[model samples]
Target: MQRILEPGQIEALASRSVPRLRLPDRSRVFAARAERLGALSRGHALQGYLELLATLAAAQHAALQSLEVTLPNESRRAAARHHGMPVIPALGEARSSAWRGVLDALRTAVAAGNYPPAVAAACERLATRSAEALDAQADRLLAVEVAVGDAAAAPLIMAALQVYWVAMAARLVADDVGVPESSGVCPVCGTLPVASIVRTGAPYAGYRYLHCALCATEWHRVRIECTQCSATTGVAYHSIEGGSAAIRAESCDSCHGYRKIFYQEHDPAVDAVADDVASIALDLLLTEAGFHRASGNPLLWQSPG
Candidate 1:
């Protein structure tokens, strides 16, 4: 079903709004994400794949429990104001040990054997890279991300590293950043969003925010407009005929782009990555209709749309 509204009522009309600032509780993010991953794995269309992801999420949670990171006191204020590209890559240069710790843990997780052999090989290679080598590799992967619209060109291990590293930077810099972001891309790392969430809680009712694929940051965007082009016209939503009402493809005629929108009201278990990964059927439906996605989930390494 399609939903449209007059242009003036939405946030995009503001043209320059503040980033919906948030700092993830490192202690809670992984565990909560693990739960969502588990649920998706147990009862979703991509069950086997989701189960592997669930394990990976749990591993990430464990790694976070022991991760040691230091945040700089300086803020990203000037950069935010100018919409400057993030100075930090997903594999930030600050702590080589921190990156190693995450990669090492991911390698162990991949070796545990539920996933395909290729995943195991990638993690092994990831674990062997030196910090200097990894830095160059990170740049290459990011270049590919830019070229392919976050497609899974890099291995899953690298995607995991991107999320952890970028998330750490975003958290450290989040408080210092201010109201200077109103674009479709992430203000923190300049990455496209995985998907948008319409939260379930009363305080967040009707609020819509795009979840960052690399850094796990969520920034608010208007509900009725096309996230890809900020178009208010020719926007329609499509969903599986008998599936949950909360999830749908927000399609735009202007850009012919669509992104998945998850309504937490109907599915509190919804997660930016987990739900997006589980909904392969919906993606197929939208693709069949010639609508493309603007961004993607890191775990799935989806090509645009």
Candidate 2:
């Protein structure tokens, strides 16, 4: 199955003249929060993450100022040698200094053999800084796109954050929503799901799962069915050595598509993007099995067809 959108077609569609989407107020807010979180997450070990987040937030806000339309090339690669590098790493000496501080704080807390409020406080402070930086960068990107008449850029950037925020929010609220017997669509976001999980332990066992792409939430999909074509025949599951039984990729011969599933009992901290990045081998295997992904990741979308 040809799951990915053809780049040339997408580019052609983007080039055609059309009215831009007017993002809703709620979407704008969600975009801001999501951008902030993304930057903060990037700087998990560096001090400048918070600043990057803030820059991204500002970019969204600025984009909203111009009728909620984003600039084209918002997703474009930077021409500079270090374009698209997260601001935290780009901060050079500042990043190193901040990392050292974080390490020292963590070390001291560990040696104390007790949770240090200061360590947590410091982390929060750094997160705030990253958020600020992201806001600024976001604003700059919006400004540049608008000035250059590239309407596509704003939406691309906003879309990236929207996906991230929705995933995070979905995860936080997954349990509240009832799990289905089988399905791949997110109950909350109504977006195509990325993975499914078979959890172990009481109350979670025997239930099949689907992970959301936008909000990063996992919900239950009915077991033994193809998420794309709803066909059960020829469905197969595979895993790598040392892989958690809770998580595996479900491949559908009928549709020639596959999605990843995660069992909560396997590893509680399994983030869709982070874990997916780490499990490229599984993806490669699925590809070899004549299956392809139905959705795209911002990081992986650049792959050649």
Candidate 3:
């Protein structure tokens, strides 16, 4: 099992830093993008109430950034994902449009604002039924779509949820069972981490935390080794001009894998997901260095084919 800093440990580090970094306010951009996406996604599965929740979550996150609220732990957030539960219908020996219908209802609820309590009740019932019917493949696809839709309309909210989910999962494993050798992958959801952070401060200063891509959990990994191959050889840091202080890509020559590191010291408001999306230049530079990313970001790859 790998070792990780408890949630309290991380908070202590955040509290002690002199001249703590300030985050940015991108709420306007997020709101504008979300509104445009809501319009485009009118007929899609992410319409209505779900879309509204996503938008509100994004706005709230932006506000939280401005207020410097320490975000919820990852484990608690992950639980919510499972709790909210995707509305998949049962194993349809036939393809079910139930999922689509549920999305439509959610959209309707968000846009119309006239959906009664009965309507919400009906939608919830349908969502539960669909989830039971859908296969794992369908479920995963739905999860991706839901995430993408939410991100398009509410990037900050989606990002925060992602982080919360991972943290919750990590807390479960680390506190209950113990950390695995490859904390590189999210133990709870079996997804790759977005980056490996070199955290500073007491009880675990200079420790490595593998940040989850899906749930945003940060699990402890040992320092001075490659997360991909567990190799201790030829690990290096590369960064783009001017962006070096804010973000850097940690490359492992042995495994040909690289992860981005966000220096919270330099910018407290730096969200791993939002800032990562904004720093494509750094990714380009890391890619040019022959290091491939172990994790994936949908927004970073939305270029037209």
Candidate 4:
């Protein structure tokens, strides 16, 4: 069994120079998460699938190394100044020529990762989609956590766009208009959050931020507030019998929604995405109690019953 660290023990760790966000170093994160997922798969019900995901994540990391996206400062601000504006251009909103590059990069990532022919083909289909089309489709799918399970290509498509958008956003947002804050959905992309992060290292230590799986951005949300319903009451936390102290689920009674939180101080190895995926037992237990996930991990797909 994995050792769980106590929360108080985590606070004792030193601080960092500044608060941290997860978007900038996309490749390193992907690589480390893949490694961690491989380790986590050693003895689990989802071992085969987890292992496959790790391989795919590694491929994404490699693909990210070579892909460069630069969003114009003007375009970024145009989207940010309005509440309804999307952070990145969607299908038809951007020209086909612009999307071709991302599609090419995704195809390479899929092929390099050695995904099956079906997955490769799926990537190709995603590649051909105009930014407007992808934006529309993803917006619909992300509206409900359960919707992702219906599309086999969902994971691949999300991963590819995540890399592309994060890369450009990291560089562009700094010089553009600031993203407006949203209580539940991501300020950057209007997507629901996948999980919250309890940061590690110095000055950033212990600060909490909600992590977006689609674009890798982190936005601040108070630790005490319910991520699902923004409720201050009836929020609860749960952990497995003997899992690492690094991860757990935060559930809200007000909306019956649950989200994973990664407290990285006690276990610096924790990641919002990888750790969330590895903690399937917590999801099952939470659901058994009537809570449901408010957000979806792009790497996971569920089949509708």
Candidate 5:
């Protein structure tokens, strides 16, 4: 007869087998993403927007280099751990206002880079906004209130927020993070995943980690499960017929939601964010087929028309 383990026993065994968190590498995460976006832009239908995001990601890398922020104090972290909450929740008063400065730095860096005239003008317009205005937009972005935030400025504001949180996540000791009750959200910042990646290499081979859209933190989750509703029964994977085998949309019939997942085994260079952005057609088809996005990409903001 086969034996089934209880939840606590399963947790205990998985703890020994799987890595809970893969913290962001402040040095190379954004840089590698920028390079990947640039590479994906060539000969693509969304070349202009991809190129713009490439520049924005490069700016994020520059801002991340000198950016500094304080992590939650031991007391806060302890309290969070006790409750199985995120160590550095992006919402509420936990986030540093220094993220505004990171936004300004990104703006300056992006302005210095080569971009289309309209994009340059948009940067100038964003620079003219008051701190309160920027904060309002940022609040909307962080809270996933996408309908009202300035679509033109959301990406820039989000980039700064990313650098702010990534700096903290990169500095975090993975062991310090609490065991989250749910695997759908980021354990570092409590944000939804941009996408999941089946990574290659020792220690993480064949393992799926959900990439946080905000802080770049990656947390391990078992495959073939609904990341949105955590439904295990009706999860399915979809991809473009005859397209790149590396990326696919993981759809859940239970929740009618979907998220893209990348397989590094098919294309070793597949990036969670970059490849997700480069594959808009898959998202369109899934949306048309009645599945909403399970999570959002930082670089892609949709405004209601």
Candidate 6:
């Protein structure tokens, strides 16, 4: 007699070969994001804002070229591996003043581009803020203390922070890190994912990975499960009637939380972060239906009302 396997069991067996984590290519991550943002802005309702983010992403790419960061030592890596925690926990890591220099690089790069007066003014104002104030703002943002952060300045601060972290993550050997027990947060930096992507192509074809909002790490997770609570039941996907076929909101009745998931098969160029922001309408619709977002977009911050 031949043995039979359940679909779930077969899936588990097949998933074993999928790479657990795919670190960002520091050289092209921001550039790809900028290109996607630029494409999304062409005829978008939020064209101006998307374009602004494109400019910021371009700056991030520029800043990243000259950025250098030191990774955690062997002791730290061993400790994190033993405890199933992030190798360089974003919230726990001690930051240096070097990030402020990344911010300056971003400001300089953005200044070279032609932008709206208001946008340029925001960049100028951000540049003039004291180092202490900038550090405080970054702490609030990194901790996801949304209410206390200046919403207008969060994106720029996040851009600089991303450059710093991406530099470290890009340089570190993936073998040095291990998945966290929590499963939902980034294994490299322990930050919430900005969005999840079902990628196309070799090695990762049809594989789903959560795109980290901070360090830009990609970690595999099974599909049709709640990314927040790990619930497998009552999971459904929602999308705008006339929106891009590539994107959808995966809402879980168990957690009542939703995160956008992009299918690269539907659109090969889809970017987890770029498309997440570009499809704000789906978020609004899901919110109206009582499904709250599982995490905030790294490029967009909302002020507390």
TM-score of 1: 0.81
> Distance from true position, residue 29, model 4, in Å?
3.0
Query: For residues 1-305, what per-residue lDDT tens digits would candidate 5 score against the true structure?
Result: 99999976986797688777789999999999999999999999999889888888888898889987888889998988888899999887767778889888888877887878866786898889998888888888899884745687778888888888899999888876887888788988899999999999989999899999998999998888899998888898899999999989999999899999999999988888889999999999899999999877888877755
Q: Write the per-residue lDDT of candidate 1 for residues 1-305, one digit (tens) a residue.
A: 88775755554555344446444566766677878878767766677778777777777778876766664324544554445545343434443556556767766875786777776666666666677666565565655455432222254545456546555654654544444345687656566788999875554566788887766767777678898888988999999999888789899999999999999889877888778888889999998999877765667764433
What is candidate 4's lDDT per residue for 120-188, written digit by digit as tens? 677677766676667655555545545553286677656666666666546644324244544576655
lDDT of 3 by residue, 185-263 (tens): 5544445666665556554455556655554445566656677777777988778776448577778878898777767
Total clashing residue pairs per candidate?
1, 59, 28, 13, 0, 0
Write down the lDDT of every candidate, Cα atoms only: 0.68, 0.45, 0.47, 0.68, 0.87, 0.87
What is candidate 6's local distance difference test score? Answer: 0.87
What global local distance difference test value does model 5 have? 0.87
Measured against the true structure, the TM-scores of the candidates, in listed sequence, are 0.81, 0.44, 0.50, 0.77, 0.94, 0.93
lDDT score for candidate 3 against the true structure: 0.47
Alpha-carbon shift of residue 228 in model 4 (angstroms): 1.6
* CA RMSD per model (angstroms): 5.4, 16.7, 12.5, 7.8, 1.8, 2.1
Alpha-carbon runs more than 4 Å astray in model 2: 1-160, 163-183, 200-205
| Highest TM-score scorer | 5
